[model samples]
Target: MPESWFVPTIAAPRRPIGRQVFDFDRQIVVMAIVNRTPDSFFDGGRTYGLESAVAAALAAAEAGAGWVDIGGVPFSPDTPDVAVADEIERVVPVVEAVTAVSDVVVSVDTWRADVAAACLAAGASVVNDTSGLRDPELAAVVAVSEATLVITHSRAEPHVHLRAPRYDDVVTEVRAFLAERIEHAVGLGVPESRIVIDPGHDLNKNTLHSLDLTRRFAEIAALGLPTLAAVSNKDFVGEATGLAKPDRLAPSIAAAAVCALAGARILRMHDVAASVAAATMIECILGFREPAFLAHNV
Candidate 1:
C-alpha cells in the first residue's frame, strides 16, 4: 500500500457519542442498519414490524455491531411520504426496545425534527440525518438533547430526486458541505464533539460520483471528525461490480474494507456479522486490534 493511503488514519480522534465512547484512533465501529420502512431498498420490508426491527437490532449487536441505526423511511425518490406520526410510531418502539436491553448505541435515521425528538426521548442517542439537514429544526433537537448528529451530504429533498446531479469535485464538495453543516449544527448549540459526517454514497449521486467519493474518502476523513461510510449493498456497489442488490455482499465487504483502511471510523452496514469480520481484519492489520487466538503460525 502507498504511504498516502494511511495518512488519514493518523488524524482519527476519539469521539464520545451518546453513552458510548468511540476511540476512532484505535478501532473501527460497525453501525448496523435496521430500516423499519416497508419500502426499504435493501430489505424490502423484512424488518418493518416492530418486533422484527427490534430483533434485527439485537442480532446485529450480538454480531459485534457497536451501533444500530433504525430508520422509518427510505430516501428513494417517489416513495410515499410517511407522516411524522407514522414515522415516529415505526421507529421509536424499536429504539426503545433495543436500548432497554442492549448497550449498543441506537440511532434514528430521520431528518424530521419531531421524529428525532421522539426517538431521543425513547432512548436513542444519535440522529442520522441523510438529508443534509434540510430541516434546520432537527439540529436544534439534537443540540437540546446533546445527542450525536450524523450530518450526511445529500443534494435532494427527502422524497424528491435531483435529476442528473453534478459536482465539480465530489470529495471536495462533500467535505465543504459537511464542514458547513458541522458549523451550522455547532452554531445551534450542538457540541462539536458530538457530530459525525457521511459522504452519502449513492444518496443523490450516480455510480461514478459515488465511486469517486469512495476512492478519495481519505479527504473526507481528514476533516478531523469521526467519519461514517454507508456503503452496504448500495447502488454504487452493485453498479461497480455488475451485481444485483442481493449479490453485492462480497463487493460491499470489499468497499467496507477499503473505507476502513482509508480512515472511516463508522461503517453503516446491513450484513452485520460479515461486516464485523471485515472491520476486525482491518483493525488487526492496522495494529489497532490483536488477532483472536492466532495459533496458525504463532
Candidate 2:
C-alpha cells in the first residue's frame, strides 16, 4: 500500500506575483502551460501565434488554472538557441495580453535575464528558469522585481543534450542540486518567500529516475518551499505506460496524484481540467481541501 502522506505546513509567507499572491500552504495551485514556441515538445507549436497563445491563456484561466506559465523557448536540447529579442517578441505580448484580461498569476519560462526582465515589465509575476539558474543574472532580475523564482534541477546546460545522464541516487542528487540553486538564488538576493523548487522530471532524468523522484518527492519538498511537479505529458509518463504523448493524460494525472500525496504544492500541467480534478481529489483525501457540495454524504 502506498503510504498515506500529510501536507506539511509551508511556513513561508504568500508569494506575490504582480497583483496576485499565492498561499501555497492553503492552495494547491495548477499552473497551466501556455507554450508559445513553435517547437515545444508537447504542443507542437499549436499556440505559437500571438492570438492563439492569448486565447490559450484565457482558456486555461477559465478552465481553473490559478497560474499560467508562458514559454517562448522550447526546453528540448535539440531546440535552437532563440535570440533574446526573439524570445522577448514571442513571450512579452502573450504575458501582456494575458495579464490585461485575467487576474491569474503569469510566469515567464526562460533562462535569459533580459527576456525574464522584459516579461516582468510586460506584467508577468514569476520567472520559471528551467535551466536551473545557468545564468545568475536571472536571479538578479527576480530579486530586483521582487517576483517569484522557480529553480528547477537539470544536469545538462540549456539547449544541450546530455546523453545517458546517470546518478548514484537520483532523488538525493536532485535534492542536493535544488538546494544549492535555492541557496544561490537567496544569496543573490532572491528571498525565500518568493522561491519555488522543481525536480525537473524528464529534464535530464530517465524514466526510472523520475519515478524515484515522484516516490520520494517529500524529500524535495523538505526544502520548506513549494515544489512544482511538471508531469504533464512528459516522456517519463510515456515510458512508464508505453503510451504516446497524445495518450498519456490518465497516467500523467496518476503520477500527479502521487506527487500531490507526497506533498507537492504546485502542479505544472498541460491538461488543466484533469490535473485540477486529480489534485483536488488528493487534497480532499488528505484533508487539505473540502468537497464542494457533499452530495453523497448529505
Candidate 3:
C-alpha cells in the first residue's frame, strides 16, 4: 500500500517546507494560476479582461489560494511573439486590479523583465518565469527587486519540446540545469532565500520523463531551496494513470503531496482547495499528533 499521506518520509529534508521558515510554520500554501490570456493550455480565453481577471484572482483567493499567479501572455510554446510592452500593458492593469481589492500575494508569470518590473511596481510579489531565465536580463530584474522569483527548468519552447527534448540522464541533467541556474542567479546578486525551483515537469519532458521527476521530486528539493511543482493535470498524469486532464485530480494531488512531503514548499495547483486540504491532512497525519477525532466519509 502507498504510505499514508500524513507520514512524510523518515529522511525528509532538515529544513521546513520551501516557503515556511525555520521548519515550524506549516500552513500549506496553495497558489492558483490566473492566466489572463486567450492561449494558455488550460483556462484560456476565460480571463482576458480587467473584470474577468479580477474575478479569477478573487475567486482563487476566495477558494483558499494563498497566492495567485496573474499571467498576461498566453503561455503556449507556439504563442505568438509578445512584445515586452504588450505583456506589460496586459498584466499591469490586472495586477493593479487584483491588488486593489485582495491582499493575496500576486505573482507575474512572464519571461520579460520589463513586464516583471512593471507588474512588481504595480503590486505583484513573485515572478514565475517559465523560461528559467533564458533572457539573461531577467536575473537583473530579480536581483534589483524584492519580489520572489520562480525559476523553473525548460530547455526550448514548450510545444516544440517533443522535437528538441534532449536528455541523456534526465535526473542528472535537470539537477545540473537547476544548479547552474541557481549559481547563475546567486552570481547576479539574487538571494537564494527568494528563489523557488521547479523542474519543468511537462515543459519539455515526455510522459516517462515527467513521471520519473514527479516521483522523485526530492531530488529537486535536495538543493536546499524551496521547490515549486506545477504538475497539475499534466500529460504525465494521463500517461501514468490513463486519466485525462479533468480526471487527473487524484494523481495531481498525489503528486503534490509526495513532493510536499519530500520538502517542496510551493505547490502551484489549479484545484487549490482540494490540494491544500490533502496536504494539510497529510501533514496532520505525518506529525503523529493524533487528532481528537477522525472524520471519514469512506
TM-score for predicted model 2 compared with the true structure: 0.96
* Native-referenced Cα lDDT, model 2: 0.88
Q: For all the candidates, what are their Cα RMSDs to the real structure?
A: 1.4, 1.5, 4.2
- Looking at candidate 1, the ten consecutive residues that score lowest on lDDT are 3-12
Top candidate by lDDT: 1
Error of 1 at 185 (Å): 1.1
lDDT of 1: 0.89
Give the alpha-carbon lDDT of every model. 0.89, 0.88, 0.75
Q: Write the per-residue lDDT of candidate 1 for residues 1-298, one digit (tens) a residue.
A: 6554663643437766767888988889999999998999988999998889999999999999999999998888768988999999899899999989898999999999999999999999999999999888999898888699999999887889798998999889988999998898888888878888899999889999988888888888888888899999998898889899999999999888888888898999989999989899898899898888768866
C-alpha positional error of residue 3 in candidate 2 after TM-score superposition, expressed in Å: 6.3
Sorted on TM-score, highest at the top, how do the candidates line up? 1, 2, 3
Candidate 2, residues 95-133: lDDT per residue as tens digits?
999999789989999999999999999989999999999
Off by over 4 Å in 1: 2-4, 7-12
